[model samples]
Target: MVNFSLEGKIALVTGASYGIGFALAKGFAEAGATIVFNDINQELVNKGLAAYEAEGIKAHGYICDVTDEDAVNALVAQIEKEVGVIDILVNNAGIIKRIPMIEMSAKDFRQVIDIDLNGPFIVSKAVIPSMIKKGHGKIINICSMMSELGRETVSAYAAAKGGLKMLTRNIASEYGEYNIQCNGLGPGYIETPQTAPIRTPGHPFNEFIISKTPAARWGTPEDLMGPAVFLASDASNFVNGHVLYVDGGILAYIGKQPK
Candidate 1:
């Protein structure tokens, strides 16, 4: 029998106050995993707690910045003490800056890289040792479609996600022997509060995204639930060092020819 059950597992999803991260955590809870999440501040953590409670999931929420190495290390230790050794980790915390490459300041570029790329590195590093000792683990990096494709006005975001893709592969390479499977979960243009403005009907970007996607619509947070659970569950034990892109076939299809 293919085992997709996450029972007895503890999952730590970073930046799960809302958006995709929250959805993923909720899915894990549905699959029987104890959910633990973190946000950058107390307010966000509180919000996340409230949201989880509203959903009937008693998730443990914490305030920790994923970019701070020491803070992440401490957070991991605290989770180990409070919850249990995390069996699954989802590095879902990140930010993007859509400024054109030429106009984007170096400071802004570094900020994107630091949060999107380095943050995962730090958090993953903090958790791997315990995972190694425990004999098995799953690390899912929340990558992006930009990891492979680039476009105008998103230079920094593209660069960060590109680096993150390689980082996901490298972690899998370096830790596979320890029974740790590290992979990337690349989401396509998802329908979130952040994308609400652009998704209005007839909006140019909305039209562009719909035309580009073979599904002819933006993906919902629900679209990623099953895939994320598969990657986090034992069903993907043999799947490592690969990226599972949930991009509504956008990556696989070329846009329709002009009528």
Candidate 2:
């Protein structure tokens, strides 16, 4: 028995195919929010839909690249007209490219920025009008540990996520009077498909990460579900413009060096 409930709210989650997005969507469903899942991969979307349906959750999947403005606008319009007003929006679609700063090309940088940063802007712009019309909403942006702590090969990703933190705050300040709450979740190296390859012993950054993370372990997608549920539900009605770190206390350390 949970204290939080989104009994009649509708949620729109981007990047719902796998990883944190999927977990957050399912969590919202369990809390009674009708889920509208979007991902670029149709097959994975179908898989998610099936998984949710098997659980008897009200979930639907749509194929849309969150970076495309027109497509995002159309998708949101369709949802508003055909589905229902989205009371919650989770901008979780993002991509990462690991390369030395010297070797990182403008194209590569833009590619990362497009998916991680621009996509959120596009999707949030499209959905917020509906939220504003309703005079209440919740927006959660999935940031990263890099949002605050900079890293070597992930400059673009870090910049984008850092920008998202401010964007969340800015939006929250702008709409707080209208009852719209905007917040960000900065996840550490979670043991999902996204971070699995990087979690191996031989991976150069693995030991360093473990040493830095006070918890001495990588986080999982499930670790984030509770936070997402709190932010999406009425439990966090007064919480806004905050970036909650779910990083195994990694950010608290001075560096990767263990004490």
Candidate 3:
């Protein structure tokens, strides 16, 4: 048996319709785990279920907004009662709004924080009790490069991700006695629909990112799968509260020219 295999785990991936969430869900299903996938888009949710069904994998989809506490709790309860015990929970739903700090309205800032930060809090609170009862579980929060570094025009996103990092640590510390592990995956500018607009031909920020990233290339969704698989499986049973950066060495440099 492979050391990192999740053969009998029932994995629940939020926002599994596309991007990193989709990749992680499919990967875990391929690794022999049953998947309970959720997304805000009904079309994507159905498509995800169909994809796994065609592959003869056990999977299902639920359309629920992660930010709604009652909805999240009900969904988790239904999954536990019907689908199976979710051995691993991947909090991969996130959004970014680009606006200058001074021009950003309070509504916009709060919106971002509600989805990126509070959404996870609500979902985790809903699912963690069952995990505690089970005495073993894994929680992988998808953070971002901005978690540690500061950037302009995305203050709310930065704050939410930064908060998520500490939340992961707190959860790990609080739950480690129950044999549960919590960790984070921070991706830097991965190639996905959310990033496409910014990297288009004439986008001013594209060149800046390329120059700043030591790899000189944007990361793809596949770039994140390995980290997710590791952190979600028994391979990382003892690894908790770690914010593993999947950036292409971009955070290492201070943008200084070589002398």
Candidate 4:
């Protein structure tokens, strides 16, 4: 049987205080993996801890900035010491700036790239050596739909995610021989609290999304859990350097013709 069990695994998900990252970590815990997560501050870490506890999951939470190379290295070392070698890593920490390209400042653009692209590079670097030694590993980069498509006011975000897509492929190329699989999990417009306002009935943006998607609905955090688990488990041992987009067929469909 193709094994999908994450038993005896240690999974580290970044920025898991809430939203998609939290959902992924919760799923991992349910699959028998020991959960380890990090946030940029103590408050978020504490929040994540409480959330995990409320879900009956004993998760290890830490405060670490993924964009800081030194901090990421140290965090990896600490996790290794405290929770066994990290068997799975989900680079889920990122930010997006939706300013138009001309209006967006270079500083703001760099910030997006720094976190979405470089942060993954830093954290993945910190964990790969141990994974190589251990003979197998999985690294899932939380890429976005912007990785492939572009929108009017999301230039920086699109650029960052595009770079991340390539980074995911490159990591797999460089480390596949070591039994390390690096892939991208690109989520479509998911229904998170942050997007709740825009999702109300009759909202133009909501209608736009619903019309564009072939599935005719927004995806939920739970929609991503199974795919995350599959990529993290032995079932996907041969699936390396591929991006599994959970975009509800948006990427595959063209919008409906005007009535």
Q: For each candidate, what is the lDDT? A: 0.95, 0.87, 0.88, 0.95
How close to the true structure is residue 116 of candidate 2, measured as C-alpha lDDT?
Answer: 91
What stretches of model 2 exceed 4 Å from their correct place? 1-3, 200-204, 255-259
- Compared with the true structure, what per-residue lDDT tens digits does model 4 show for residues 18-105? 9999999988988999999999999999999999999999999999999999999999999999989999999999998889899999
- Tens-place lDDT per residue, model 2, 180-255, is 8999998888887756787899687788788778898888878998999998878898999999999999888776
Worst 10 residues of 4 by lDDT: 95-104
Error of 1 at 13 (Å): 0.4
Compared with the true structure, what per-residue lDDT tens digits does model 3 show for residues 210-229? 87899988999788888888
Put the candidates in TM-score order, highest first: 4, 1, 2, 3
The TM-score of candidate 4 is: 0.99
How much does candidate 3 score in TM-score? 0.92
Over all chains combined, what TM-score does candidate 1 have?
Answer: 0.98
Error of 4 at 131 (Å): 0.3
- Cα error, residue 138 of model 4, in Å, equals 0.2
**Model 1 per-residue lDDT tens digits across residues 1-259:** 9989999999999999999999999999999999999999999999999999999999999999998999999999999999999999999999988788889899999999999999999999999999999999999999989999989998888988999899999999999999999999999999999999999999999999999999999999999999999999999999998999999999999899999
Per-prediction TM-score, please? 0.98, 0.92, 0.92, 0.99
RMSD in Å for candidate 4, one decimal?
A: 0.6
- lDDT for model 4, please: 0.95
True-structure lDDT of candidate 3: 0.88
